[model samples]
Target: GIYLPVGLEKAAYNDGRTPIWNAEGCTTADIVYDDLRTTNGWDSSYKIDFSDPCAQKYIDSQARMFADWGYDFLKLDGVGPGSFKSGDNYDNVADVAAWQKAIATAGRPIHLELSWSLDYGHVEDWKKYSNGWRIDTDVECYCNTLVGWENSVDDRWDDAPAWTDHAGPGGWNDLDSLNVGNGEMDGLTNAERQSYATLWAIAKSPLYTGDDLTRLDSYGLSLLTNREVIAINQSSAPPAEPVTASDPQQVWAAKNPDGTYTVALFNLADAPASVTADWSTLGFQGKASVRDVWNREKLGTYRDRITQALPAHGSRLFTVTSHGTDLEWTGYEAEAGTLSGNASTAGCSACSDGRKVGNLYGGGKLTLDNVVVHKAGTYQVKVSYISGDARSALVSANDGGATSHKFASTGDWGTVNVVHVPVKLKAGANTITIDSGSDGYAPDIDRIDVQK
Candidate 1:
């Protein structure tokens, strides 16, 4: 977990004891698996056959030697089931286990990091044996620069979420490398450089820069050295959950233990974008104080929500703390309700619990079977939704007469807005059905909130 260089080494450099080239007069031939042939393809190099006992011995010995040599980290690259596909059913699980066992028996503590998109199916194994596992291919663009967004840096946005729960305390998820300490050589615009660091921090991925430390520009230095932003990464907080699941615009948030929340808004689109973060999705009610973490500026307090216009691929991180009389609100995620016809649950970054019920059109409907109320009365219900175009849907309580509600355009589908509707609820349990009728299409339903 410490970043100071204690020395780092890979497992493929061994010669006589590990995988040997198909050479004559090699004494360690018994350790090599004769059944299959695996090569590095660049030269006459062959992969280490981890299934052999002697090969494992060599790996274990190398680990112990590294530990004794004051090495603090070991990164095993080209691991299988996700990394190298030699087409011979090559799996490096045994090799990883050997290294893990070796490091444990070693006299010194060493960090074990697996690399190049290790299989998530064996994530439990990675979590158990290594300190971190890379979730995507190399972030490097492999061109003249260290990295480029379109090639691989942007790939993490689609891949990291699935591996969120797999990262934590003793072990972490490695997002390749943090390559933003340098300016143009980092191969990203100033906006993108910060956003890159933001995602790696909030996701709690190991933050080791790929850029040269001696050449950090002021903007790149600021992005890397901001204490408030670094605190979010080191807070050991769970990975931020996306409030809006769409691309081009995303809102991610995480709750801290000190009655505060960390929220990040991203604009991945080509043009400017207004990204909004709702208090309901952040699991709080009432006004809250917001501070821009990167700018180290205390923004004024706001009630219910806040919006920021960000440039292309830009991002903002904020810490929000509630300061008003806290109102208790009950939220019923639309995905938890029953779906009929084409209605179904889908991932939405701008919704409560990262999900929403959509496709409510032409016989599609969502029925909440257990909507409870203490007393019979009319109450305000806040329905959260996303709509680029104006739409309407019918809401019926207890299969009673339906009332149609119109939703105005919120500018785009990436933004979420709440509309309050007065609905009468009987004492105890009540059923509410949101239907789009035979031919009408309704806006996507994130969730509905009611004051308790």
Candidate 2:
């Protein structure tokens, strides 16, 4: 769509705010001006105007020609319908019917898959027209060095749970492609890549290999081919969600036919964390043996819980006939926010689960919701953060009072730094806030941890 704005569509304006109309004068209020542009850009040379009948005939012929060419899967990228309206705009609905009808005429079972993040409200339309759709954004994820809570592959993990009902049988929520095998494109470590694969498998997203298959490393291959994990995915069992998505201490569990569960405990933080999954919360009142699904080794049986220490972005995917308790108070479980700027809940490199990113100066603040303390006492609150220079932040717990914490130079953006302050809190849910105190830099905070 970037070759030239005028070529995509004729309009009084080509900026994102203006509306675009087809030849039929079919204009939509729900669609932003940008939504009306060409999908893949294909250099703007061979673009189809869905509004034209001649274009419809061409699309039909193209579909039949694709069938003739023996291509089974056709991913029609960036085509949404007027039915999937944004705001008040009636965005042009591409001539998808032409493709469907043409493929039918060609007598081929060509599976249509939509590209980009289709509007969630149009799931039924997707199921009717395509075999799968991407539920997340793109896969150009920068791994841990990135800071936003919602980005690329990890965002898929966050979104999969909510769309479980949309996935089953022929229809699926595609988690894009596997970014694990690529060394340069993705920034995930080996363990993180393994976690990514495990998550995709558990969520039952179609396993499209985004990497060069011929050059797949042994470890990547192993992660992709682990039969037990694949069985859990292919079992067609329901997708798993976080029992408690406590950053650095989240628990994701799926039920099995044998009355067992595949529970994955993820440490989505920068530092190491000992996270536990409660048996009761997991719907098991008693105990069950926990076995590592990847290694095929028994981690022994436990009565009421299982807790494991995990590194940054590390995960433990295992099966249990019976198991234990997990962590509490994850990232962005914010009960409140006085924060300005784009707060990133996405895990950063070597930072705790997520950070509140904003110009946290001049009374700019980020409040972490539901900070729990065991007893009413003084505790040291540590904020894992990022900054290229030194700064200071004011903190308060449950409005008990405010304390100031100072941060030193962290050398680089990815070099995680920490600052701590002592504050008193009650035994229940308390709100802890960080405010910029110094005049220098407002550091990117990864997470706030209060220790008694």
Candidate 3:
């Protein structure tokens, strides 16, 4: 989506970009006035009275024009129905609805995203008409450098959790641009950069790179491409929440559907300190193995708790899984299977073996060659997969008839879910296959667990 202002309001009064106000058919009836005129820090500006038919028609035309130009996403900034304390007095619900109607009329799947500290009171309306909405002020410092800590980035930590329930598959809480892909010019320290990326990823905010790609530094590039960290961002899981609301030293955690947890420890103080992740707070029991997501290193197994000495403003991400003494199920990792067509393996820090099979659709398939079972009978096999939208897959055993299973949204691509499928198996080694049928794409498979 291209970033474009709503044009209903301007940075400065009478800055000379008032198409809706100057249209031939439009009159004073289309403009909104009163205390809201200069209350928004602008000396003078005009607000579009969306209630007026002329104003609605004018916005409709603009939306249709943008859609016709092949824009699949639209970031409509400076929208209203916000807080009056922030100088937004008029409602823009009709305006947003007008754009929604216009896009549907144009027959395009353009994503309408509202921006600039949108009102939480009208959240349902925002969700109804848009794919995402900005929950806070801009993260940009608007200085010689891109951004600074005190300006707005830190504000998201407080503002984000308030809107967690509001974010999901189709709609999300946008935290503005992620400006950590460039060094020096990013106006952040190395530790700050990692913290910035970690928070945005775990919060499920859109990871829009707000930096110069051509001048990316090695550290910045690594932060942007870390597959393990990106998995947390892409997961269909909800935003991670503060474990104990402690300042200077904070811990956040999110439980994954496949009985795993993504944990982050932060030292937000000016000096180095110890940050700890408590298993009780994370809702886990027994000894568990931890993997450092950023460094991609297994940190060994621990019981009850794990602590790390972090540099000030530094953060750490880890995926924790319990190792219980049970023989109820046997695991088969997808990445170990034969990938055919477009099917391939990708690093998933949260999955077993740190990899999973993906792109299984349109001739893509995964074949597990030696899926041995003790007896020739029906076994409940748990398919662990990730998906952000509705999908289906075909699973078969020993070249038998395939069983089609429909999967519902798991929230995003990072979160994992398990579905049980009854597969008739032989007493010895048997083969299992997974692929998309004659329908839509298949979910990325993490692994399958056969009931023992």
Candidate number with greatest lDDT: 3
- What tens-digit string does per-residue lDDT give for candidate 1 at 1-452? 32211111223434435443332333245444453245321212344565556565665566666876899887777666567443444466666777788788878888888776777667788888888888788899899899987888876766665566668898888898899988689888988898899999999988888788889898988888888888899996787756544445777788888978899999878788998777766656679999999999999899988889999888999999987565567789899999999999888887778898888899899988788878887655778887666678888789579888765444456567665555788988888888998999988898887767
**Candidate 1 clashes between residue pairs 3 or more apart in a chain or in different chains:** 243-349, 243-350, 244-349, 244-350, 245-348, 245-349
Worst 10 residues of 2 by lDDT: 1-10
Q: Would you list the C-alpha lDDT of every candidate in the order shown?
A: 0.75, 0.61, 0.75
Put down candidate 3 lDDT per residue, 192-296, tens digits, no spaces.
899999999888888888899999999999999998898899987887766534356777778887878888888878789998776655544458899999999
| lDDT of residue 256 for candidate 3 | 85
Ranking by lDDT: 3, 1, 2
Sort by TM-score, top down from the best: 1, 3, 2
User: Against the true structure, what is each candidate's TM-score?
Assistant: 0.71, 0.59, 0.64
Q: What residue runs in model 1 are displaced by over 4 Å at the alpha carbon? A: 1-27, 39-52, 84-88, 324-452
TM-score attained by model 1: 0.71
Task: List pairs with backbone clashes in candidate 3.
Answer: 13-44, 234-414, 235-414, 235-415, 236-411, 236-412, 236-415
Better of 1 and 2 by lDDT: 1
Poorly placed runs, candidate 3 (over 4 Å): 7-45, 83-88, 324-452
Q: What is the lDDT of residue 81 in candidate 1?
A: 54
